[model samples]
Target: MPHTISGFSKLSKSEKIEWLLNTYFTDKDSARALVKQYWNTDDKLQKLHDEFIENTITNYYLPLGVAPNFLINKTIYTIPMAIEESSVVAAASKAAKFWLDRGGFKAEVLSTEKIGQVHFIYKGGFDKLEAFFKNVKPKLISDTASITKNMERRGGGILDIQLRNKSEDLPNYYQLHATFETLDAMGANFINTCLEQFATTFKNEALLFKDFTGDESNISIVMSILSNYVPQCLVRAEVSCKIEDLKSKDIPNPEEFAEKFKQAVSIAEVEPYRAVTHNKGIMNGIDAVVLATGNDFRAVEAGVHAYAAKDGTYSSLTHCSITDGIFKFWIVIPLALGTVGGLTSLHPLVKFSMEMLQKPTAKDLMKIVSVAGLAQNFGAVKSLTTTGIQEGHMKMHLMNILNQFEAADTEKVTLIEHFKTNIVTHSSVVEAITKIRESGNFK
Candidate 1:
């Protein structure tokens, strides 16, 4: 059994690793060696990685790849994606190349509004709380002037503040709902600061309100924070071409492919089970780019999932249609991304990713990220409607499976050629490799 030690954080890096190994592993030498194997060789870089989070032991790596030929808003871009999944980058690239000749993708920002709230309880009459809120609203705004001054100068600051009463739903629950334009920053910290200030002023003023009687006078603030549900902060991306132009090598018949693709999206829109997996495919691309850029994928995932279920039922984020001679596929998702703040300037790879993107603004990043989701969905739907998803996905996954079997470079080359015609399954690959070894074919 492991015992908890006080002041564990005060230990030196080596000391901490020693304690962890002693506590957990029987073979401490080998375990310690395994941990240090991932550390950066450069002393300065390793230190930088260690300081990125608390109680850091060593680095965890994911492949950073680029998907080229993404034409958005008539501008060509090569998107950088950091992910461990086998087929995500390949799928996204295929989709981008497919649409590249078909007029590529078009994207536009619908809105840039974000939200925050302050929750408090007041066991008083609703009318009395409403009356007090109206009188205190201006003061709440004024008290946050210091916090909003810099943001205002940047042309992005508090947009509006409104009081909401939810006494019927939860006894004496009230919220100070606020909206903001964060410009080039994700603005969580900014919105949270303003909310905390608003909560302070609200509680301070409620104590002095003349209308308050009994429990109404004692307003207890529960918490103040920025919401991850920014429905209004939306971006739309789409690809459209003549129905005849949708024909490809795999999709020999444009009309059949288009019809099948439309039906697939429609099913996802109404079926919760399909919709959940469908949206996850879209996020495989979105989250990869979001992570590469050093933005918060968790917040993006939360906001987008909420937006999908906004109609009281979970549904697909991407939609498709074939009208007249045109076939179109598109998605509109809420993405609050930043190009200037947080890790964008600090992390080396993040800075490189911004440069690779031509240093887009928040709105531009929104368009790019939305296009990524749309392109990813296109690839998935196209696969689902045609040769099915596994053929391509498993082909990309073949290398990973090969590596797991401990195949040598020579064996990998032989298997790659052999599997070109044969179906690539784990069992089949393993059996073939074992037979080849027993035959002494390569040796």
Candidate 2:
């Protein structure tokens, strides 16, 4: 069911927040039931909620406004995201909706597992360690599988393993990477746990081998580091629209928009500053999905920026172009997010938001996430080239800024709404605030 509608000017601040609050947690019994189903104790629930309140970077409760029309892989998803920018949400939603009037956005995802790195510090030769690990690859794979047994039973676990030796001048000189399929789970903690298991398994097993290092105490470094370059779960979204549906004001030939977009990317490839802004727009959509679903936005940002420079120049993560009437968009990001672990499960609304998305594998979820980014990119360029981003963005922003001064109180908001139609000018707003000040209404 759609949430009950409210005029933006009329909603109380507390009431607005109520929309984002997990409905399951609003009642003590429902929260308790949910907590018990996943958590071991009531204490854990308290800690989760406390972390959600104090630690999670809440984005001021902006609705992860829906795009209204996105049909991907026979599944219809109205993508949800929480972002403060106005045109990003507004343009994407409207543009998507317009396309939906024709056939709808067709989207797909590649896969959903993440890869983490295991670094080992040793004084020995990396070549020797590399050969040793190569011989033990089967054992290492089996050993890692044993750790994620529960996950495998549920159709997820260690999917594959690859080994590499870095000869850097470091104490613990060996590095091993294990790729695991976590299904709907994020797999960070699980992958890290497996790394620990491997560390101990190798050390104990090493003692049994003749060629093993004699220095026991020297095996002092073993840590699992999360890698952002997790092979991407790809997402693709395309909208086929009739020329009549597009406004020439937005683009003379909507079909040409795609060609222009393709050419625009060449500029991004050549210019570092434009590349930064372009990638930032992509992140704007991606980070919101990560946040709304309770994934690590910071790490996602780090990985994306790092990936942008992979070609030696900071460039856009996605590419866009229009051949004819068809517009094509694609984004490849190392989006290794889990739906059922850590903050994603701990946050009150995270689970609910996932449910709203109708549940998807982490990799498939990344596909959805990437499409939203493409939509955001298109929407961004559309506004910049058309209405100018500020006109629409500041209109919404001013409302928020204005509320900060006078809409803090319900009566004041009621006054603002009651008179919104009449108070169109800055001077009118000033006059009303002045009148309220003279009347001591703010008090």
Off by over 4 Å in 1: 441-443
How high is the lDDT of residue 387 in model 2? Answer: 58
**What are the lDDT scores of the predictions, listed in order?**
0.92, 0.65
lDDT of 1 by residue, 4-109 (tens): 8999999999999999998889999899998999999999989878988898988889999999999998999999999999899999999999999999999999
Candidate 1 least-lDDT 10 residues: 434-443
Scored against the true structure, residue 401 in model 1 reaches a CA lDDT of: 90
C-alpha positional error of residue 253 in candidate 2 after TM-score superposition, expressed in Å: 4.1
Task: Give the alpha carbon lDDT tens digit for every residue of 209-251 in model 2.
Answer: 5565667325544676657676554345555454444545556
RMSD of each: 1.5, 10.7
Candidate 2 lowest-lDDT run of ten:
52-61
Give all TM-scores, in the order shown: 0.97, 0.74
Clashes of 2: 11
* Clash counts for the predictions, in order: 0, 11
